[model samples]
Target: MDCMFKKIAKQGGDIQFDDVETIIGPSVKLEGEFQSKGNVMVSGVLIGKLETSENVRIETNAQIEGDITAREAIIAGNVHGNIIIAQHLSLLSSAKITGDITAGSIAIQQGAQMNGKCSMVATVEPKPADVKQNAASVMQDTTELL
Candidate 1:
């Protein structure tokens, strides 16, 4: 049991995979939001949002029904919500996406089905207090001048 625990731990908690980079199985189903600090490979059905600081890889047989917020995402399955990626997004041949996508880079395979808008954008940092204050003051002064 100790060895089994160790093996499972190495594969990332309760999720099991033959390869750390691959998630392939038929009977898996996940519900509710999932937050991961590392990469995620999903081959099952997920009914909630996926949040990852690294990359998210969804296999061809997988189905996700909620939003995805990640640094990068590679999808080969079905997605039904908005995708907000900081870096890159790729849709493979079997992908079926039905919502908007915002990412720094994107790639769509030939046979993929996509029905949404895509925007290439950079990550934005919040303005510092000084900058915000200065801008507000400038705007006020301009309005007064007008």
Candidate 2:
């Protein structure tokens, strides 16, 4: 887990996978909107809108079939929908986005792919939370996913 954030020092490395409140595992396939106030990390298939007030990380093997709205995002997978970020967004080399993008700032790696229009918006500030809570204690519908 520590190795994953080594290259993401810019966001202050404040959000980690282990500290995520909602995690969609690689083998799980979910079909519903994901709304949360806390950070989320998806490594599987999500077939609905995802909105959050915090950071989001979409892993290399993940696949998203709907729009994503978040404060910030780190994507390294395939996204079939639009993305809107309040702050910075990083699209790794393995990322493949097929929809429009709206973000305050963006970093695209050499091999990243995005096939739609992009717009930059004004971002006031960014402040990721420092508190971490166990996923098991989270009462969200997607918690403790099997």
Candidate 3:
């Protein structure tokens, strides 16, 4: 597991043939919650939640029916559930996603399909005071215009 994560961390952001801690083959079907401490690669069908501490890769023939939570992900398959990624996410040309996505950053290749909204998350949140100040300034500007 440690070796797999080291490979994931050392590699560039592109999803390549990195070391995998878990691999689900094309003939297998998995149900129930799947958790991993390292990288996961799936080429099969999954019907439950997937949570990974590192990266996740879904191959072109894969199909997933539940939510996915990962630090980073690359999808080249069919997914019918929401995805939450803490870092980078890439949807390849063959990917089809049917649910909303939340990620720190995302890249969608040509021919990729998505039916739901995508929201980008920031690594650092603004301070409450900063938000309040911005809102107050905006309100003041509007009032002056009125």
Task: Give the alpha-carbon lDDT of every model.
Answer: 0.75, 0.83, 0.85
Task: In angstroms, give how far residue 134 of model 1 lies from its true place.
Answer: 17
TM-score of each: 0.69, 0.76, 0.75
lDDT of 2 by residue, 13-88 (tens): 4434445778888998999988999878888999999999988999999999999999889999999998989888
lDDT digits (tens) for residues 1-146 of candidate 3: 23323433223455434668899889999999999898898899999999988889888899999999988898889999999888888898999999989888888889999999998987624447999999999999999999
The RMSD of every model to the true structure, in order and in angstroms, is 9.0, 12.1, 8.7
What is the Cα root-mean-square deviation between model 2 and the actual structure?
12.1
Which model scores highest in lDDT? Answer: 3
lDDT of 1 by residue, 17-88 (tens): 222443434578888988887767787899999887777778778899999898767788999998988876
Sliding window of 10 residues with minimal summed lDDT for model 3: 1-10
lDDT of 1 at 44: 83
The residue pairs that clash in candidate 2, if any, are none
Candidate 3 deviant stretches above 4 angstroms:
1-17, 124-146
Which window of 10 residues has the lowest lDDT sum in candidate 1?
3-12
